[model samples]
Target: MNGKQDLSKVSVLLVEDEAFMRRLIQRMLEDLGVGEIVLAQDGGEAVQYILNNSYAFTLILLDLEMPRVNGFEVLKYLRSAPDVGNHDLPVVILTGHAEKERVVQAVQYGIHGYLVKPVSKADLISKINRAMTKPPIDASHLK
Candidate 1:
């Protein structure tokens, strides 16, 4: 799939703690022709943004670790919050090489996909396409 064309109308929420990585990913998203990219430095800020904003996001690219709320907490909130209306929203986890346990937990939480740190542009685009086209995850089993 051509990411630039496919993503042209899609808005994304990027939750990353590191400044450099965030900027890098933002550039990659821009290059892919993503419509609007909303950035959150950490999970706390991301949750706040989700609560306050009425705009719908096409996808969420989230880092596993952060200072305040952490990605897992954010994922749980998204899945469980009655008013959020984003339980089915596609979420892709971003993790380092050592975070195997976290990745497993994220899968149990119904993550759409995941990418290791220092993600390549090709991989990012590929994952985004896959997540966008993949069927929604059923989190009811978790209850």
Candidate 2:
């Protein structure tokens, strides 16, 4: 448990429709000592949740392809507002993809970072820590 724990210190918003995938990511974040976890069944819910509770989340792990409101749409929604107070929230796309062009496109869209699906708890923890603590490409640079 080196450099780990204090679950009451971190909060996460998990946006995934797949119940199993959501649970898995939740468990992984929890194991990393996230204090609170917000579960959004779809992109619509995720957006609303962020609007209503943006201040609570230290990070958001989003999935690219989802029903109703895909991750791209959600990101667009967030960017369009610019008032959610989460414009800088660490959002890491967790998906089962590794296409270079797709990744670049995502980066162009202002994603804080990304991790392939089935991401290990350890990797999640590491990425989570880095995303929240590091200086992501300045918000001003996002197109």
Candidate 3:
């Protein structure tokens, strides 16, 4: 992709537990010109997928609350796992909780962006564009 408008080269791992929400986000991503999307129902599944295919995704759209492992845990794992080779991967938190504490915590975890529930396409695209422009997080900074 040459510019923010062209996400044709972008590939994402969408980790969401809700089936309906997952489909909705997937459609939005497709509309944004994303080339590939890998789905994970929960954080544990996301972890497994990331481990198996570390370099496959250009970004991750992670849900904060899930049945197994939650987004926070997944973030920690990604930061700590040397073998995964994804410590710098962009992760945008997608959550219903917009509480100050939760948002602060996510920021501390080095999330690229945070999107509240009922996300609009415009907001999503803007956030994605902003995140994509930033330099990848250095794993050493987390420690």
Candidate 4:
């Protein structure tokens, strides 16, 4: 059923303010055999990391609530980057937020997937794998 998410070469970027959450997600991604994981504390760092780095990451796990910059803003920025919106870069909004508005807003911002907080290793790993193997959205829909 196309469940074989070939993620052997996937690189990940995790943006979260909480240290524990960040570490937990990192470990979970590692367990999934995802190659290369980087952490960013805020939207600014996330933006800088993507800009400074030459290779585009396979996925980005963004937290909704962050200081200085938020997930929505970061998603918007990433989509606006040259050759990025159409690129097969998956971004998942993983946070504690459950509001319908927040979820809708995230979807509108062009992320690949969304997962609620307190996520277990199984859930986290599965979501990331799905993002890697699944096809990305159209570029026109991103803006």
Predicted model with the maximum TM-score: 1
Error of 2 at 3 (Å): 6.0
Cα lDDT tens digits for candidate 3, 1-143? 22248787888999999999999999999888888899999999999889985448888999999986999999998878887876888889999998877877777778888899887888888778867888544444544
Answer with 1 or 2, whichever has the higher TM-score: 1
The digit string of per-residue lDDT tens for model 1 on 1-143 reads 86646677898999999999999999999998899999999999888878866778999999988887999999999989997867888998888754656666888778888899899999899888888999644445434
lDDT of 4 by residue, 1-143 (tens): 12245566888889999999999888877776777888998889988887865756878999989989988888888877684434346888887978867777777666667789897876777777667667543445534
| TM-score, every prediction | 0.90, 0.86, 0.88, 0.83
Clashes of 3: 0
- In candidate 4, what residue range of length 10 has the lowest lDDT sum? 134-143
Badly placed stretches (over 4 Å) of model 2 are: 1-7, 137-143
**Whole-model alpha-carbon lDDT for candidate 4:** 0.77
For model 1 the local lDDT of residue 6 reads 60
Winning model by lDDT: 1
Give lDDT per model, in order: 0.86, 0.79, 0.84, 0.77
Mark the 10 consecutive residues where model 3 has the least summed lDDT.
134-143
Model 3 CA deviation exceeding 4 Å by range: 1-4, 135-143
TM-score of model 1 (CA atoms): 0.90
Could you tell me which 10 consecutive residues in candidate 2 have the lowest summed lDDT?
A: 134-143
